[model samples]
Target: MNELGSRRLFFKYAVPQMVGLLFNSIYLIMDGVFIGNRLGRIGMAAAAISVPVIEILIAISMALASGAGIMISDRLGRERLGEALRIFKASILLSALVGSAVALLGNHFCHGIAGFLGATPGIHDQAVGYLRYIVLFSPFLLFSFLLGGLARNDGRPGLAMTALTLGSLSNVVLDYLFLFPMDMGIEGAALATAIGPVVSVIVLLPHFLLKRGRLYLEKATIRWKDWLDILRLGSPSFVMEFSIGIITFIYNVAIVKNGYGEIGLAAYLVIGYMMLIFLTLFLGMAEGLQPVFSYLQSVGNHGKNDELLSFARCFFLAIGISCYMGIVLFGRDFISIFSPEEIAMIDLAEKASPVYFAGFFLAGFNILAISFRQSTGRTRSAMAISLLRSVAIPPVLIGLLPLILGRESIWACHSLAEAGTACYIFKTTRRNERWEERWENRLPRYTVEDERTTRSGPSTSRST
Candidate 1:
C-alpha cells in the first residue's frame, strides 16, 4: 500500500473489487432482463416484488461477513493471526446455521411471505414461484456473498473477482437456458440466480484448500462472545441491507397505490436495476478501501487515513457525476436493454431519470463516508448514517412526497433523501474531528499495534 501513489493504490484495489461487484450487480440486471423479455411486464413486477426476500437474505450474510471481515482485518494488522482465524471460522459457521434456518422457513411459507411482502393478487402466484426457488437455495446466495467478502479481506481480491465474474457469467447463460428454451418461467430465473453461488464457491475453494493465502481455518472453540462481536461490529451493515429491503418493499407498495399498479412497478424495476449498477461501483470502492483503513487505524496512521479519505471522496464524486451525465444523455438506451420494445415502461423511467438519479453524485460520497466511519472505529456514526440513508429517510420521503405533492413528485424521493443525508455526513465528519482530538491520546479496546510480515507472510508474532 505504501509503495503506490494514493490513486494507483486506490484503483489497484478498488478496480478489481469494482469489477467483481459489477458482475454481482449484473446478476440482478440479468434476472430482470430475462424475466422482462420472457414473462412480460407482469413477470417483471413479480420479480420486483420478490426483491425484498433477496435483500433480507443478503442482509444477513452481509452483516456476518462485514462485521467479521472488519475484525479479521484488524487482527491481521496487529499480527493476531490466531484470533483472525477464529473469527473467520465462526463467521462461516454462523452463516451456515442462519442460512439453513432461513431456507427451511422461507420455503415452508413461501406463498404466505410473498403476500406479506405486498405482492398484489395479479402477481402473487408468480411472486411465490420465484421466491420459493430463491429461498430454497438461500444457503448458496448467503454463502457466496459471505465468502466473497472473506476472500476479498484475505488478500485475494483477484480470486474474489474471478469467482463472482464466473458466477455471473454462468447466471447469464443459465438464465437463457432455463427461461427461454426450457420455458420454466419465473422459477427458472430464481434457479439461475441460486446456481450462481454454487459457481462462485467452486472458484473460491482453491484459496482455502491450497493454502495460497494468509487466512486459514482450524479447530477453534466458537464462543458466544465471538459471535456477538461479529454481530455488533456488523450492525451498520445489517441496517444498510435491511433498510434497502424495506425501501424496496415500500417503493413497490407505493407504486401500486399510485394507480399505476403493475405498469408503474415495471418502470420502477427498470430504474431500480440501474440504481444497482451505480451502487455497486460506489460500494466496491468503499469495501476496497476497508482493509487499508483498518490497517492504518490499527497502526494509528491517521495522516495516511486522512489522505485516503480525501482521495476516495474526490474520486467517487467524479465517477458519480460522470454516471449521472451518461444516464441523462442516454437513459432511453439504458432502459432499452431490459425491454427494448416496451416503450411505456421505457418512457416512464426515462422521463423520471433526472429526479430519480439526482442524488448519485453526492450519494457516492455519502456511501464512501459510511465505509470510512465503519473502518475507523466510528461505528455509531456509521450506523447513524446508514439508518438515515437506507432505512429512515428514503421511506419517509417516498411516503410523504406523493401524498403532499401528488404522485408525479415521487421520483424525487430518493434524490432528496440522499442529498439530506450527504449534508448530515458532511457536518458530522467535522464534529467527529473534535471528538478524535479529545481521544487521540487514548486508545480504545480494539486498537492494536502494527505487524510486519515475515518471509512466510502474515507472521503470527508482532515485531518487537
Candidate 2:
C-alpha cells in the first residue's frame, strides 16, 4: 500500500469491492423484482416494510465487524500481529452471541415487530411470515458479514469479494427456485436472502482457517476494553447501516399517512431498490478504503492518507453525478422492471424519482466525509454525521416539509436533508484538523527497521 501510487491503490481495493457489491445488490434487486411480479404491489410493500427489521440485525453485525476490523487493521499496521488475531477471534464470538440472542427474540416477536413497523393489515400477515425466516437464520448472516470484514482487513479483498459474489449468486438461484418453481411467494424471497449468508460464511472460512494473511483465528478471552473499543469505533457504521432502515420506515409512514397508500409505498420501494445500487457504490468504496486509511494512519503516512481522501471525494462526486443523470434518463425503464403490470405504481415512482434523488449529486461528498472520519478513528465525528444524516434529519424533514409545502413536498425531504448535510460535512472537515491531530498521537509510528522486524517475525505482518 505504501509503495503503490494513490490511484493504483484506490483501484486495487475499490474496484473489486464495487463489483462484488454490485453483484450482491443484483440478487437483492432480483428478490424485489420476483416478489413484485409474482405477488403484486402489496407483496413489494411487504418486502420494503420488512427492511427495518432486517437492517436492525445487519446494523448490529456491521457495527461489530467494522469496529473490530478497523482495530485489527490498526494493530497489524503497528506490528501487533498477535493482538490483531485476538480481536478477530473475539469479534466472531461476540457476533455469534448477539446473533443467538436475536434469533430467540426476533422469532418469538415476529408478528408484533411486523405490525410495529407499520405494516397495514393487507400486508401484515405476509410481512410476519417473511420476517420469521429471516430472523431464524440470524447467526449465519451475522457471521458471514463479520467474516467478510475481517478477511478484507487481513489483506484478502479478493477473497472477501469472492465470498459475497458466490453467496449472492446462490441467492438469485434460490430466489427463482423457491418463488416460481415451488410457488412460495414472499416467504421464498425472505428465505433466499437468509440463505445467502450461509454461502458467504462457507466461502470465507478458509481465509482464517488456512492462515492466508496476518490474522488467523485463535483462542481469545472477551475483554471488556476490546469490546468497548470495537463498539466505539463501530457505532458510527452501525448508525450508517441502521439509518437506511430508519429512512425507509419514515418514508413508508409518510407516504401512507398522506393517503398515497399502498401504491405510494410500492413506488418508494422501487426507488429505494434502485437507490440501493447507488448506495453499494458509495458503501463499497468506503469499505474498501477503510483498511487502507487505517493502515496508512497506523504507519504515519498522513500525506498519502489525505491524498487518498482527496481522490475519493472527486471520484465519488463524479460517480454520484453520473448516476443521477442516468436515473433521469432511464428511471422509467428501471421502475418498470419491478412493477411491469402496474401502470399507476410505475408512473408514481417515475414522477417521484427525480425529486427524491436530486441529493444523489451531493451524496458522495457526505458519504466520503463520514467514511474518512470513521477510517481515521474520528469516532465522535463519524457518529455525529451518521446520526444527523440518518436519524435526526430525516424525521424533521419528512414530518415538517409536508406540513408546510403540502404532501408533494414529501418527495423533496430526502434531497433537502442530504444537501443540508453536505454543507455540515464541509464545515466539519475544515474544523477536524485539531481532532485529527489528537487522534494521530494514539496510532503507532513505524520506522524502516520496525517494518523489517515486523516482516521477519514468526507471523509476518505486512501492510497491503
Candidate 3:
C-alpha cells in the first residue's frame, strides 16, 4: 500500500475495532450497574475492588498477544512464516496454561486482598462467590484476548472485532440471565463476564482454522525458541501491563489511607471504568500503529516513517484533546452509572478524574514510545520504558508525594506518576535513536514489505 493507502488501511481496522470495543466497554459498565443495584454497596465495592486484577489480566493478555503479533507480522514481511506461525501457536498454549494457573491461584489471592478493598463479613461471601466464577472462566478470557490480537495481526481484524463484539454483547445478555433470570446473584455476574469471551472465541476460530491469514498457529509451529521469542517480546508489555495491578494496589492503599472506604472504593471504580475506556482507545491506536510501524521498517521507508511518526504524534495530540473534552463534558454521565447513590461522590470523582486523566494526553505519547521500542525488538529500551513508567514512577510518586505534601498527596499520585512517566518517555524519545540503531542492523528490514517506499522513523512507536 502507498502512503495514503496505508493510512486508510490503518483507520479501516482501527475504527471498527474501536467501535466494537465500545460495546464491550458498555457491557462492563452495565455489569457494574447491575451488580451494584442488585448487590449492596459493599458487594458492589468488592467487585469494584477487583478492578486492578482485571486490568492486570488484560494487560498480560495484551502484552502476549500484541507483542507476539508485532513480531509475527515483521517475520511475515521477512518471509519467515514458519517462525511466525510457531510463535503464534506457542502464545496460545502459554496463555492458556498461565490463565489456568491464574484461575486456580488468583482466587485465593483476591480473597486475601478483599479485606483491604472493603469486603467485610456481610459482603464477603458474595465477593468470593463473584470471584469464583470468573476464575473458572479465566482460560476463555485469556483465549479471547490472545485470539483478538492474533486475528488483528493475521490480517483479519474483522475476525478480532467479531470475537470481541460477540463476547461483549453476549456478556450483557448472559449477565441479565444469570443475575436476574436465574437469580444466581454475584456469581451470575461473574459467569456472564466469563461467557462473553467464549462467544468471542467462537467468532474467531473459523478464521484461524480456515488458514485465511498470512500468519497462523499450525501444529508444526509449536517450538521452544518461538515460545521464548514471544515471551521475550511480550515481557516488556507484561511488565508494562501487569504493573497496573501493582500500581493499582498502591492506589487502593492510598485511597484507603486517605480515608475513602467503600465510598472511596465506589468512586475509584467509577473513575476506573472511565479510565478503561480511555485506556482501550489508547491501546487500540498503539496496537494498530505497531503493525504499520513494522511493515514500514521492513520496506526501508525509514524517513517517511519518521514523518508518519510525527503525524502520529500530532494525531495523538488530537486524541488527547478529545479525551479531555470527553471528561469535561461527560464525566458526570460516566460516573453516575457506577455510583448513582451519592451526588457528592460523583462530584468528588469528577474533580479527581480530570486531574488523573490530564496526564492521559501524555499516556498516549508513552504508549506510542513503548510501541515503537517493542515493535523493532529493542528489548532493553522497551523494558526500560516499561519499568520506569509502570513500576518505578508510580511507587516513587506514591511514596514521596505523601511525605512531601501530606496525606492528601495520596490522591495526587495517579496524575503525578503519569506526568513523571511522560517526562521519562520524552527523554527516551531523544536518546532512543542511538539505542534503536544498536538493533537496527541486527533485525533485517528488507525481507518484508515494499521497503523501498516504506519509511520508518526512529523505530518503534517510541522513536517512531
Candidate 4:
C-alpha cells in the first residue's frame, strides 16, 4: 500500500470493497422484492418487522470484525506480527462463541422477539418464521464478516470481495429457487440469507489456513483484556450497525402511531432498500480505506493521511450528491420494482421519498468522518458521531417532530437528524484539525525508518 500512489491505493481497496458490499446488499434488496411481489404487503410488513433482528446480528458481527481489524492493521503497521496474529485468533474464537449464543437464545425466544419488534397479530407468525432461520444460522454470518474484515486488513481485499460476491450471488439464486418454485415464502428468504454467509466463510477460510497474508489461524492464549480491547475499539461500529435496527424499530413505531400501519411499512421497506444500497456504498468505501488510515496513523504519515482524507471527502461528496439525485429522479421507478401493482404503496413511497432522503447528501460524509476517526484511534469521537446520527438525534426527531408538526412530518425525521449531525461533525472536525496542526508543529519532524517495514508486506510464517 505504501508503494502505491494515493489514487491507486484508494481504488485498489475501495473498488473491490464497494463491489462486494453492493452485491451483498443486493441479496437483501432482493428479499424485499420477492416478498413484496410474492407475499404482498403483509409479507413485506412481516419482513420489515424481522429486520431489526438481522441488523442486530450484523451489528455484533461487524463490531467484532472491525475492532479486531483495526488492532491487526495497527500491529501489522508496527511490525508486531505476533500480536496481530493473536488478535486474529481471539477474534475467530469470540465470533464463534457469540454467534452460537445468539442463535441458541434467539431461536428459543423468537416469538417474544417478534412481538417486541412491533409485529401485529396478522404478521407475527411470519415474522417469527423469518427470524428463526436467520438466528439458527447466525454462526456462518458472523464468520463471514469476521473473516472478510480480517482478509481486508491482511492485505487481500480482492479475496474478501470475491468471497462476499460469491455469497451474495448464491443467495440470489437460492432466493429465486426457494421463493418461486419451492413456494417456501418468508422462511425461504431468511434461509437463503443465512446460507449465503456459509459460502463466504468457505471462500475466506483458506486464506487464513494457507497463511496467505500477515494474519492466519494460530494457537494463542485468549485473554479477557484482548476481548475487552476489541469490544472497546469496536463499540462505535457496533453502535453504527445496531443503530440501523434501532432506527427501524423507532420508525416502525412512529409510523404505526401515525396510523399508516402495513401500507406505511411496505412503503418504508422499499425506501429502506434504496437507503441500504447507498449506505452500503458509503460503508464499503469507509471500510475499504480503514486499513490504509490505520497504517498511515501507525507510521505517522500525516501528509499522506491528509491526501487520502481529501480524496475521500471529494469522493463521498460526489457519491452523496449523485445518490440523492438518483433518488429524486428515479425513486418512483425504484419503488415500483418491489410491487408495481400496489398503487397505494407506490404513491405513498413516492410522496415520502424527497422528504425522507433530503439530507442523505451529508450522510456519506458523516460515515466517512466516523470511519476516519475510528481508524485513527479517535474511538470516542467515532462513537459519539455514530450515536448522534443513529441513536440520539434520529429517535428524538422521530418522536418529537410528528407531535410538533403533523403526522406527515415523521418522514422528515431522518433528513433532519442527518443534517444536524453533519453540522456537529463539521464543527468538531475543524476543531480537531487545528489541534492536530498545533500538536504536530510542537514535535520534531520524524522520517519513516524504512518503507518496507512501514508497508508491512504479507507474512509467510505459520504459527501454532
Candidate 5:
C-alpha cells in the first residue's frame, strides 16, 4: 500500500466529488421541477430548449477545469510543485476571461442561437427572459467551476462539495421564493438559479484569497503561451460536451422535421437531463479514480493502474445495467415530472433513454482510458480516443443516422457511438499496456551507497 491508497483517501476524495456532482444534479432536477410545475408547458419546453446553449458554456468551463486539473494533478504527483501552481492560477484566469466572453456573446445573440435551435416565434420571449438573467450570472458560474477544480485538486473535495451543495440548495429554495411567491414568472426561476452560482463563488473566493489551502489564488504574469496546453489538453473534454451541443441542435431539427416539433423537443430535453443525472454516476466513478490514477502513474504503479482501468469498466457496466432496468421498469415515473399531459411523451422518453444510454457502460471505458493515458503522460492517446469518440463519430452519427432511421435515430446515435469507440479503445489499450510496462520497469533503482550501510565500520554490508 502506498501513501495514497488508504481507505481514508477514497472516502475523503471520492465521496466529496460525488456529493458535489450529486448536489449539482439534484438542483438541476429541481430547476426542471420548479419550472415545469409553476410556469406551464411552454415554460418547460423553453427551459428544455435552452439546455444546449448552456451546455456549450459548461462545456468550455469543464474543458478547462477538468483538463487543466488532470494535468495539474499529474504535475503535483510528479513533485513539480511550482509548475502545478502556475497551471492552477493560469487556469483560473483563462476560465474567467473565456467565461465572461461566452456570457456576453451568448446574451447579445441569444435570440439568434435560440431560433436556430428551434425556439418558436410564439415562445421567443420566454426564452429571452430566462437566458438574459442566466447570462448575467456568468462570472459566478465560471469562477465556481475554476475554484471547484482547484478544491478537488487540492485534496479538499469537501470544500468543493460544500460550495456546489450550497449553490444548489440556494437555487432550490430561491426557486420557490422568487418564481412561485413573487410572481416573477419564468424569468424568476432563471434568476434564482443564476443567483445560486453567484453565492457559491462568494463562498469559494475566501479560500483563494486567504490562501487557506493547497489551492489558493496567486498573482502572476499571465503566460499567454501556457494557454496552449490548457486548450489542447482541455479540447478533448470540451469537444466531448460541445459536440453534444451540436447533437442537441441537430436532434431538435430532426424532431421538427418529423412533425412532432415542440412535443419532440420537450421529450428530448427531459431525456437529456435524465441522461446527465445518470452520467454523473459515471463521472463520480471517473472522478474517484482521477487522483488515484494521477498518483499511481506518478509512482509508476502498473498493476494498480491496470486494476483501476478494469475497475472503471466494471463499475460503468454495472451502472448501465441499473439505468436500463430503471427505464424499463419505472419509465413513466421518470417522465412523471414533465406533466400528466406527458403520458405519450413519457412512453417515448422511456424507449429513448436506454437506447441512448446503451453504451453508457462503454462510456466508462472511454473515460477510464482517457484518464489513464492523461495521468501517465500519454496525452496523444487520450486525444486520439477523444477525437474518435467526440469529434469524428458524433457528427457523423448526426448526419447519417437520421437519414437512415428517421427521428428516433437521433437519440440512439450517441450510445451507438459510445459502444463503437469503446471497441477501438479496448484494442488500443491492449497496445498501451506494453508501453506502460516498459515505463514501469524504468523507475529509479537504488545505488550501492544505502541506508543499510552501518556507520561504525567499513565492514558493514549493505543490502540492495
Candidate 6:
C-alpha cells in the first residue's frame, strides 16, 4: 500500500469492492423479482414492509465492521499488528453477541414488529414470515459483513470480494430453487436471504483461520472500552446505513397515509430497488477505499490523501449523473421486470422515478463525503453529514413537502435531502480548505522567524 500509487491503489481496492457490492445488490433485486412474479403485488408489498428490519440488521453489522476496520487499518499502518488482531477478535465477538440478541428478540416479536413496520392485514402474515427467517439467521448475516470488512482492512480485498460474490451467487440460485421448485412462499425468500450470508462467512473464515492476513481468529480478552470505541468511531456508518431503513419506513407510512395503499408500496418497492443498486455502488467505492484513506492518514501522507479524494470526487460525480440518467430513461423497463403483469404499478413507478431520483446525481457525492470524513478520523464531521442527510432532513421533507407542495411532491423528499446535504458539504469543505491554505501559507514565515530567533538568541527576538 505504501509503495502503490494513488490511481493503482484506488482501482485495486475500489473495483473489487464495487463488483462485489454490485453482485450483492443484484441478488437483492432478484429476490424482489421472484417475489413480484411468484406472489404478485401482495408479495412485493410484504417484502417491502420487511425492508426496514433487514436494513437495520445490515446497518448494525456495517457499523461494527467499519469501526473495527478503520482502527485495524490504522494499527497495521503503524506496525502494531498485535493491537489490530485484538480489535479484530473483539469485533467478531461483538457481532455474534449482537446478532444472537437481535435474532432472539426479533423472532419473539416478529408479528408485532411487522405491524409496526406498517404491514397491513393483507400482508401481515407474509411480512411476519419473511422477517422471522431473516432475524433467525442474523448471526450469519452479521458475520458475513464483519469478516468481509476485516478482510479488506487486513490487506486482502480480493478475498473479501470473492467471498461476497460467491455468497450473492448462492443467493440467486437458492432464491429460484426455493421459490419455484420447492413450493415455498415468502419464507423461502427469507431463508435464501439468510443462508447467503452463511456462505459468505464460511468463505471468509478460512482466510482468517489460516492466518493469510494480519488478522486471524484467536482468543482475546474483550474490554468495555474497546466496544465503546468501536461503536463510537462507527456511529457515522451506522447512521448512514440505518438511514436507509428509516427512509423506507417513513416513505411507507407516508404512502399509506396518502391513500396509495398496497399498489403504491409495490411501486415504491421497485423504485427502492433502483435506489439500492445505486447506493450499493457508491457505498462500495467508499468502503473499498476506506482502508487506503485510513492508512494514508496514519502515515501522514496528506498529498496522497488529496489526490485520492480528487479521484473519488470525480468518480462519484460521474456515477451520480449516470445513475439518474439511466433510471430516468429506462426506469419503466426496470419496473416491468418486477411485475410485468401489473401495468398500474409499473406506470406509477415510471412517473415517480423522474421526480424521486432527480437529486441522486449528488447522492453519491454526499456518501463519498461522509465516508471520506470517517476514514480520515473526522468522526464528528462524518456523523453530522450522515445525520443531516438521512435523519434530520428527509423526515422533515417527507412530512412537510406534501402539505406544502401537494401530495405528489412527496416523492421528491429524498432528492431534496440529497441536494441539501451536498450544499452543506460544499460550503463546509470549502471553508476548511481555505483555513488549511492560510495555515500552510503562514508555515514558512513562522519557520523563518523561529530560525532567526534561534540564531540571534532572546535579545534579538525582543529587539524585533
Estimate the overall C-alpha local distance difference test score of candidate 3.
0.74
Clashing pairs in 4: none
State the local distance difference test value for candidate 2. Answer: 0.85
Give the winner by lDDT: 2 or 5.
Answer: 2
**Which of candidates 1 and 5 reaches a greater TM-score?**
1
lDDT of 2 by residue, 1-464 (tens): 89988898898787677877788888878887788778877887788767776778778887888899889889999999889978888888789888898899998998898888779998998988888888899998889878888878877788888988999999999988998999988888899999999999999998788887777777766688888898889998888877777788789889999999989987887888877888888888888888889999999999999899889888998898899998899999998876588899999999999998888767677777777789888889888888888878889999998999999999989878888888888887667767888899888877676677777864355343
Task: Summarize candidate 3's per-residue lDDT along 1-464 as a digit string, tens digits.
Answer: 23555457557556556666677778888888888777766656667656656766777787788767877778776778887887777788889888989888877676776666567887777777777767677888778878887877776767777778888988888877887779887777888887898898888887787877765566774777776777778777777667656766777777787677866766776787787677667667776666667766766767755766676677777888798898989888878866577988898788878767777777777777777778766777878877877678887787777778886566667666767877877776767667888889787555333353366533333211
Candidate 1 structure quality by residue, lDDT tens digits, 119-210: 99999999988888888888888788778788878877778789889999999999999999999988888889889888998888778767
* Poorly placed runs, candidate 6 (over 4 Å): 119-125, 258-262, 440-464
What would the TM-scores of all predictions be?
0.88, 0.89, 0.85, 0.90, 0.85, 0.92
The 10-residue segment with the lowest total lDDT in model 2: 455-464
Report the Cα lDDT for residue 383, model 3: 86
Per-residue lDDT tens digits for candidate 6, residues 112-185, read 99999789999999999899999899999899988988888988889889999999999999989999999799
| Candidate 4 lDDT tens digits, 273-345 | 8888888898888888888889888888868887988898898889988998998899999988767788999
Looking at candidate 1, the ten consecutive residues that score lowest on lDDT are 445-454
- lDDT of every predicted structure (CA atoms): 0.82, 0.85, 0.74, 0.87, 0.73, 0.88
Local lDDT at 364 for model 6: 85
Clashes of each: 0, 1, 15, 0, 0, 0
Deviation in Å, model 1, residue 13 alpha carbon: 2.2
Candidate with the larger TM-score of 5 and 6: 6
The total number of steric clashes, by the backbone 3 Å criterion, in model 5 comes to 0
lDDT of 5 by residue, 137-253 (tens): 777787786677677777767787788889989999999998777988988888887888787788787887887866665666667766888777766666655655666666667
lDDT of model 2, residue 243: 76
Ranked by TM-score, the better of candidates 3 and 6 is 6
